[model samples]
Target: MRIVATNPDQTQAVGKKLAALLQPGDLILLAGDLGAGKTTFTKGLALGLGIKRNIKSPTFTLIREYKEGRLPLYHMDVYRLEDGGAEDLGLEEYFNGDGVSVVEWASFIPEELPAEYLEIRLNKDETDDNKRYIDFNAQGKHYEKLVAKLAE
Candidate 1:
């Protein structure tokens, strides 16, 4: 599914909607360029999950955990692992554990990803700095349904 966000708020609204449909063990892969509002989207997710804490990018720390929400949130940024070594992080545990996992720059650790997951790509419009095209690509039946509900 393709979602057009005219501004940051709209993009974050999309994230809130998706967060409502998330279940334990859900894996969401976010692929986008810098300044694409990935972190902004996640802030909305945190709010939807009942997390009141600040939601920041995990770029430097690699992973940030928020357990105050209805479901724990494991936000990860593996961009720093571009050269390899993601295996040491035990990413599968988070992907398979209770609570949802949202991965940024997931392509860096393709081998660590589960077979079934949701991939979201944020493409910025060249002509409009604030516009973003959020593309959803489901990798499994469950994700397909999730995307359908999100579109609704």
Candidate 2:
């Protein structure tokens, strides 16, 4: 599916919509460049999950956990990883845990991700300042359910 985001709030709204469809052990992979509103979308996700605390990118920390929501939120930014794969960060635990995981710069840690995921790509539009085109591609049966829910 394709979504047109005219501003940060729109992007967040999109995330909120997706968040409603999330389940435990689900992995949401976000792919995009810096300043592409990935964090903005995450904030909306946090809100949708019933989390009121401040939601910030874990760029420096590698992973940030939030348990105040309906399900735990394991927010991760893999942009800082150097060499080793999931073993380096022991990130396999998070992927297999009982929570919803949203990984920013997920492409940087492809091998660490599940066999399937709800992949979201954000792209800047050259025609406008707040314009963005977001794409959603699902893989595996689990994501197929998510896609169907998202369509509804």
Predicted structure with the largest TM-score when compared to the true one = 1
Kindly list the per-residue Cα lDDT of model 1 for residues 1-119, writing each as its tens digit.
99999999999899888999999999999999999889988988888898999999999999999999989999999999999999999999999999999999999998998899999
| Backbone clashes in model 1, listed as residue pairs | none
How far out, in Å, is residue 133 in model 2? Answer: 1.1
Model 2 regions lying over 4 Å from their true place: none
Model 2 agreement with the true structure over 2-90: per-residue lDDT tens digits: 89999999999988888888888898888888988889989989989999999998999989999999889999998877454556776
TM-scores of all candidate predictions against the true structure: 0.98, 0.94
lDDT (0-100) at residue 81 of candidate 1?
Answer: 100
Best by lDDT: 1
lDDT against the true structure, per candidate, is 0.94, 0.86
